[model samples]
Target: MATAPEDGMKHPRTTNERLIDATLDAWQFGGGATISVRSLCASTNIQVSSLYHHFGSLEQLLVSAQEHAIDAAEAWCTRQIGLLADDAMPPAALGALLAGLIDDWCHDERRLAFAWRECHLNAVKQATFIPLAGRWTKLWSGFWAELCERLGIAGHAITTARFFAGESGFHLVPWNRQIDRAALGETCTGWSAWLCGQVSPPSPWRDRARALAGAGLVLPPLRDDVAERIAATAGAIVERSGVAGLTYRAVAVDAGLTLGVVSHKFRTGADLLAAAFDALYRRAATRTADELADLPAMQPEAVSHELAEMVVGEFAGSLGLDELLLACARNPALRPFGGHLRYLRGRTSGHYLAALLGPAKPTHHIDAAIFSSFLIGVTGVYCFVQDREERIAGAEAEIARVIAALTGG
Candidate 1:
C-alpha cells in the first residue's frame, strides 16, 4: 500500500493524509479506478465520519489524490529537465533522454502512468474532471515546450509534445510479447536527433519494428447485420460512459432488441465488448479509407493540414475509440483484435506521408506510427485543454513542420 512520503523521520499520518494515501494506493495497485467512501474506509480502517470531515466527500478526496499525483509527476519531469540542461547535453542526446523518460514511465513507474491515463479517461467522461484534466494538459504541454527549447529543438516543440502524449497512450496497450525496449530506445534516439537537425545513422532495428505492422483494420463479417447494429449500440454506450456502461440490458434497450437475443448473440460482457471494439475499429477504418482516397490529388501542405484535422476530429468527436482499444488490451479474448491497432494506426498517416514524400521516398510503417501517435497526443491535449481553437491552429502548423522534417521535404 502507498503512503505519504517521509520528509526525514516518519511522522504519524493524519486522517486526511491516510485517506489520500489509501486512494493513491488503490489507484496505483489495487484496481481502484472507481472508489467509494466505503471502500476507502474499509481499506484504511478509518470511520466514514473522518473521511467526510477531512475531504467533505469522496469526490473531493479523489480530486485531491489526482492533484497530488500530477504534482509529483511534474516535479519529477522538472528535475529530469533540470539535469539535462545542467549537463548541457547536445541535441543528439534528446532522443536518448526522451527514451529514458518514456522508459521510466512505461516500466519502473508504469502503474502511475496507468493510473494517470485511467484518470484522464474518467476526466473525459465526466464534466467534473474537466478542470483537473485541462490543467494537466497545460502543465505537460509547457513542460514539453521547455524541454524542446532547452534542447535546441524549439521549432518542433508543439508537435513533439502532442506526439509524446500519443506515444504515452500507444505504449499503454499490454502486448502479448515483451516490447523490444532496446530497439525502441535506439529508434527513438535516432529519430529525435534527426528531428533536431542531426544526420542520424539509421537504427539497425528499424526494419524489425516496421515488421510489427498489421494488415490494417479488417473485421470478420457478421452472419447477420443485426449483430453489427447491436455492436454499434454497445459502442455508443462505451463512447458515453466507457466499457463499464456497456451491458446486455443497456445494449438491448438502446438497439431496441430483446435482452435474451442480445445475450444469446454475445453471451458475455467481454464478448459484447469485443464486438464493440470491432465495430469502433470498423468505423475508424472506413474513415481512414475515405480520407486516404483524396490525398493523391491534394497538395503536400493541404495533406498535412487535413491529416491533423482528421486525427483530432476522430478522437475529439468520440471517446469510444480510446476506451475500446484499452478494453481490448485488458481482455484476453480481445487481445488479438487489439494487436492490429498497435501497428495499423499509421495507415492513414502513411498514405498522407506518401502523398507528401512522393512514391520514391520510403514512408516506413514506423514513421507512420510515430506520426499517427503524435496526432493522437495532439488530440488528447487539445480536447481537454483551454484555448482550444488557438492550440489547434498552432498544432496544425507544427504538424506541417513535423511532416516536412520526417519526410525530408
Candidate 2:
C-alpha cells in the first residue's frame, strides 16, 4: 500500500467516497472525461440536484476527480520513496516503479494519453488539474534529484527532472501501433535501466518505480512494436477522412481499444485531432530541416515556394478546416478568434512576410502570418481539383502572384 503524508487528505477510497471511488475506477480502468458525473450518477442513480450538493457543476466534479488523483498520486509516491530509506537508489527498483505507474496507475499507454490530451484542449479541466500536476511534478522531481545525487550526475533538480520526463515518453506511445501495457512496462524498465547506466534518472523515483513494480504494485514497463499501428491509424484518418473522422470513439473502435481508453487519453474529439495534427507536423518538420536551415539565406522565390508546399501538403487534408471556417462565419462570436488567427499567423503569416520582404532577418513572423491567412482562404475555397499537375502549377502561380503583391516583385 502507498503512503500519504500526514496531510489530512481524503483517501480516494472513502471520505468523499463516491467521488474518489468513481475517479479511481475511471482513471485507472480507462474512464472518459465526462465519466465523472455520468459514472457517479449511474452508480448512485441519484437526481442531478442531489449530486450538485456535493459538486456544483461538471467542472467542479472534475476538480473533485483531480483532487482525488492528486491524493492518490502523493500517497503512491510517498510509499515508493520510503522504501529507499538510506540505501543508495537502486536501478532495477526504479524501473519497476516507473513501469508500474505508467502501465498501471497512470494507465501508462492508457490514462496518460487522456491526461496529455485534456491538458491541451479542455480549459476548465486544465485549470482543475493544475494543482495535481504541481504535486506530480514536485514529487517526480524530488525523486529524480535524489537519484541524480546518488549516481553522481550534477545538475539543478528542475533541469534533470524535465530531461527525465521528456525522455520517459519516447517509447511509451504506439507511434507505430499503440503500445500495449506489457510492452510499456518493458520499455519503462529498459529506459530506467539505460538512464541509470548512463547519467541516471533523477534517483529515488527511478529506483522506487522499479521497486514498486517488483512488489506487485505495478506492471513492468517496456516498449511495444506498435508504431506501425499508430502510423496506419493516423494515415488512414488523414488520407481518407481527415480531421472530422478522427473521433475518439472511431479511433478507439478502429484501434480495437475501449472507447474509455481513447477518451481517457483524449477527452474530446478535438484534442485527438490536434494531437494527430501535431504529430504529423513534427514528422514533416523533421524533413524540412534543410529548408529551415536555408531560410536565413534563401531567395524570396525559394521561400515562397516552401510556404506554398506547406499549405498544400501539410494542411490540404484537414477535413475540419471547412467546418471550422463555416462555424466562424455563422457564429458571429467566433469571428474574433484570436487564438486561431494567432496560430495561423505563426504557421504562414511570417513565411509570406519574409518571402516578400527580402533575405533579411525578422521577415518570417510577419510573412508567416500573411501566408497563413492565404492558406486559410484556400481552405475556404474547398478546391476539389483532382489533377496534381494542375494543382501544383496553380499553387506556384498563386505563390508568384502573392509574392508580387507582397514585395512589389
Candidate 3:
C-alpha cells in the first residue's frame, strides 16, 4: 500500500495535491503557456500518469494552475481588506493599503511571476483561461468598487481597477530588473493615492510644455534621417519602459533631440507609437528573414525542426520584439498597428509554408494564423523566465511542438 505523507491525506490525494502545487509553481516560473507536462513532472518528482490521473489534460492542468494562483491572490486581498475595520476606509488607511499591495506585488516573487503570466495570457486571448482571468478581474474590480464607495471616490470603479491591474504588470518590469525598489514603491503609492483622489497636483508635463512654449524656442523641421532616429528611439523606449513610459519628452531626451523636434515629426502620441511599432515590426521581419535564409533547405520530415530553429534564433537575437508586442497588445492606440503586424506575420508564415510545401493550401492560411498566435504566446512566456539558456531551450522545444502541430508532422 502507498504510504501517506505527514499532512494526513491519503496517498492519491497527497499525490494530486503535490502535482497541483508543483504545476502552479512551475507555471508561475516557466509561464503558463510554455510549461510542458514533462517539465512539470521533472520538477515535481511525479509521473505523467499521476498528472493525467489528477488533471486529465495539459490544458486542464494549466487551468487548474490559474485557478490555484487566482484563489491564493484573492485570499490575500481579502485578508488585506479585512484590515479596514470600519465601513469607510480613511485616506491614511487607503494609502497604507495601496502601499502594502505594492510591496506585495514587488517583493513577492510568486506574485510577480503570476501577475506577468496573467498579463501574457490575457494579451494572447487564450480562450481556455478566459474564465479564470475574468474571475481575477472581477475580484480586483469588486474590491476597488467597494473601497471607492467607502472612500467616496467618484469614478468608474471597474475602469480604475483595470487600470491598476495594467499598472501592476508595469510595476513588475522594474522589479524584475532589480531596479530601485524603494523608488518604484514610492511611485506606485503616489500614483495610487492620486487615483483615489487623495492628492491633486498640477500636471508636471503640462507645466513643462508651457515652459517650452513660453521660451519661444523655434525648432527646425525633422529631416528624414532624424525622423527615423526618433522613431527608433521611441521603439527603444517602448521596449525598455513600456508604452506608459513612451513620452515625447522621454524620446527627445533619449534621441538627443529637442522635444519640439520629436513633436514636430510625430505630431501625436498615437502617431509616434505607430511609427515605433512600424520600426519594430520591420526590424523583426528583416531579422527573421535573414536567419531563415541561413537555414538549409527544409525536408518535409524535418521542416518543423528547421522552422523552430529559425524562430528561436530570431527571438534570441531580436531585442525589442517581445516587449514591443506586449506593450502594443495592451495599448489601445497601438492596436491597429499591432493588427497590421499580425497580418504581416501571418503572410510571412504563409510564404514560408509555400516555400516548404510547394503550394499553400487553404488550411495553410489558417495554420499560419495559429502559428502567429503560438509565437506571441511563446515569446511572452520566454520573457518571464530568468535563465537565458533554459529560455532558449524551451523556446526551441515549444516552437517545434507548434510547428509539428501546424504541419501535421
Candidate 4:
C-alpha cells in the first residue's frame, strides 16, 4: 500500500516517475529479490506496457532502484557528517555523536528500511551489486574516517570506520527486535569507546601465563576423535545461532567438553568456524552430487523445472545454510572458506547446465555463473521471508524463468 511522493497538488506524477517510486518503495520494504514488474505495476497502478516502456527488465529496474537508494543514503550521511563537523566537541563527545547518529537512523523509517534491504542484498548478491555496495561502503567508511581523524584517533581509519559501521548495524538489529533503547545506546557507546582506543586492550601475556598455570592441571590430549566431535558441535552452534554464536565456550558447552579442551583443539574462534564450514561444505557438496546423480534424464525444456526442484530440495535439506552464508559474508576471516563454498555451488550449477545445454560453451559458462549467483540471492531471500513454502515457490518460479531466458525456450 505504499505510494509515490507527490510533486504538488497542481501536477500529477508521470507513469515513469510513479514506476520508479513504486520500485524504490517495494525494494525498501521487501528487498530487491521480491520486487517484480507485476508488483511494481500493482503498486503504481500502471499497465505492464508502461512498466516495460520505462524499465525494459526487472534487473534493470532493480539496478535503478538500488542506485536511487544508495544516492539517498549518501546524501543523508553527508548531511549528518556535516552536522557533526559543525558541532565540533571534545573527544568524549564522540560517543554522544554516534549514539545520536544511531538514534536518527533508527527513527528514519525510509533510511532504516533501505539499510535493511541493502544489508540483505549485500549478503547474497555481492557479485551483481559490487559497484553499489562499494559506493555504500566508501560512504560510511569515509564518514567514520573523518570522525576518527577529528577525534585524534590514529591507525587504519577506514578499517576502524568499517568495523564501527558494521557493529552499529548489528546493534540496530537487536533494537528493532524491541530491546531497550538505553541498552542499545550503551552498547553502541561502548563500541565507539573501544574503536577510539578509550578502552584498554586485553593483556595477551597475562592470559598466556594463566593458560600456562592451567597446563599443569591434567587434561585429556586433543586427539583426532575429540577434534572431529568439537567441529561437529561448532557446526550445530552455527546452525542454531549463526557464526557469531560459534564461540569456543559455546562449542565446549554444546560438545560436553571442557573450555580448555575446545581451546586446545581449535586455538581460535576462526579456526573453529573454518572447521565447521569445511564439514558443512563437504556434506552439502556430497548431498548435491547425490541428488544430481539421482535426477532422471530429461529434455532441455524440462531441465529447468527439474533444476527448480533441485533448488527447493537443497533449501529444504539445509535450513541454516542461508544464515551461515550471511555470517560468512560479513566476517573477513571466513572469506577463504566462503569462496570455496561458492566454488562448490558453482560446480553444482555447472553440472546442471551441462545436462541442460549439452556441450558447454563460453555462453553456457556465463549462464551457469548467473544461475549460481541467482540461487545465492534466492537463499538470501529465504533467510528473511517468514513463509518457507511461499519463498520456495517463488525461488522455483524465478529459476524456471532464468532457465527459459538463458535457453531461449
Write the residue-wise lDDT of candidate 4 on 147-261 in tens digits: 7677765433543443344334333332112322443344344444444433212333323322442342222233598898987787767666656577888988899999999
What value does the lDDT take at residue 4 in candidate 2?
A: 79
Give the best candidate by TM-score.
1
> Candidate 1, which segments miss by more than 4 Å at Cα?
1-9, 25-33, 82-85, 126-128, 193-220, 267-270, 285-290, 314-318, 328-338, 385-392, 407-409
On lDDT, the candidate that comes out on top is 1
Encode model 3's per-residue lDDT on 13-124: one tens digit a residue.
4766676777665544444434678988887788989889888997787676667677777776777667766676554344446545655754574543454445444433
Supply the global lDDT for candidate 2: 0.44
Could you give candidate 2's per-residue lDDT for residues 1-409 as a string of tens digits?
A: 6777589785644425666456545543332333556667777656667667777786676666655555655566566556655655544465565545544433333344334323222331245555545555566667767655654443323333443343233222222122234434443444443333221223333233333323421211212334334434553554344333556566766777777765665555444544454444344333354556567577766666665565554443343333232222223333322123222223433434554455543432223432443444342221233455454555566656544433333
* Residue ranges of candidate 2 with Cα displaced over 4 Å: 1-15, 27-33, 36-39, 89-128, 154-156, 163-289, 292-409
Candidate 4 lDDT trough over 10 residues, lowest sum: 171-180
RMSD of each: 4.3, 18.1, 20.0, 19.7
Error of 1 at 213 (Å): 8.0
lDDT of 2 at 376: 42
Q: Which has the better TM-score: candidate 1, or candidate 4?
A: 1
1 against 2, candidate with superior TM-score: 1
Per-model TM-score on C-alpha atoms: 0.82, 0.41, 0.46, 0.46
